[model samples]
Target: MSTTDCIITSSVVPDELRLNVLPCYLGRHYLTGESMVYDWAARLCSSYEGGHWNFFTLSNGGFYMAPSNMDRVHVRWYMNGYSDMMGADAFGITVTLFALCHLAEHTLDDVIVTRYHQLREFAVHHAEAANILRAID
Candidate 1:
């Protein structure tokens, strides 16, 4: 695959996100950051029964974890009423973007705006960008 056809991954979730995203955003627990994302995703993703999942994050700050199966976890959810099969990677990133979008709509918090842009920039280049944008639209 070419450079434009790949997504960066981490063998495990980054520890830093426990403080920035997991606790307040994904869940209230610190240590269960990984599980929190998985559990929340369970609402839509059909399964995590696949092999070990890999984590994806941006250089600035964000977290998305997806199983190794090319099928990934099929997610059937969307904020805009558009729904279809989207990999867990794309689904997770899309939800995070939506959450950030809603939060930013209220006030112009620099931190929130920065994170929104960071993840948006990352998502636009991601291999699953099409799925993500489809869900968002």
Candidate 2:
């Protein structure tokens, strides 16, 4: 599957904010993947134009899709994990955080768990804090 396959990105404010808010696109969209990266820790995001979907590695662990399209698009994502529908940006962040939390819980790895907490701490200040909390909760 590709990243940002079904997502869009608008103008980034300062370009340095941890959770730079971006506009969302419309419709039910998604990036499709076979099995290239459903188990790895993380990978550097690449340009979708370059044939690779943008997947970003979080500081804690695991990865999330970054909006590669410059035009803001609206996408209603159905998070199968929790049956929750969310916007593109919120979906990416929440799913990434969810993976970290699940990894920590299942593996019981001190390091992974710590990373989950670290990201969770930072997420509280994110623009999509409420959405992230709902998914993670």
Candidate 3:
């Protein structure tokens, strides 16, 4: 990808929404002063199937799966199977977004309860981000 094929904005989400797609801002720092990406990863891991998400960090890139599927989980072509940084980050966001949308659908059907506030928050944020991205597109 060329340098120009990227987006460099003051906002991570489409607009300036802090709690947009992600549970928290990706660019912020936690109380430990570490990047919020770590916390985001943790939250994503905890988002579905009672925190059975398995996140593996390989030398190339990382991939995650819910319900601890060993045979079903493998690195993608982009993971080398892609980049150690970009690939992992991309897959992490994809997984989080997928979980959020999937749960949101079931929640709408009243199949899933909002017992976990994190899941509800993620669904709401992802919805808001999707609407903003759609408008931008």
lDDT of 3 by residue, 2-75 (tens): 53343322212223442332223111221221222234344433322233233322211211222332222222
Off by over 4 Å in 2: 1-85
Backbone N/Cα/C clashes per model: 0, 10, 4
If ranked by TM-score, best first, what sequence of candidates would result? 1, 2, 3
Candidate 1 RMSD computed on C-alpha atoms after optimal superposition onto the true structure:
6.4
User: Across residues 1-137, which tens digit of lDDT does each residue of candidate 1 receive?
Assistant: 86445564433456554345445433333344454445545555556443455556555455555555556445555445655676656766765666555555645556556656767777888788888777666
- Evaluate residue 96 in candidate 2 and report its C-alpha lDDT on the 0 to 100 scale: 52
Q: List ranges where model 3 is wrong by over 4 Å.
A: 1-86, 109-137
lDDT of 2 at 65: 45
Each model's C-alpha lDDT? 0.58, 0.41, 0.30
Which segments of model 1 are wrong by more than 4 Å? 1-56, 61-81
Top candidate on TM-score is: 1
Per-model TM-score on C-alpha atoms: 0.55, 0.44, 0.23
Q: Model 2 reaches what TM-score against the true structure?
A: 0.44
Model 2 misses residue 80 by how many Å?
11
TM-score preference between candidates 2 and 3, better one = 2
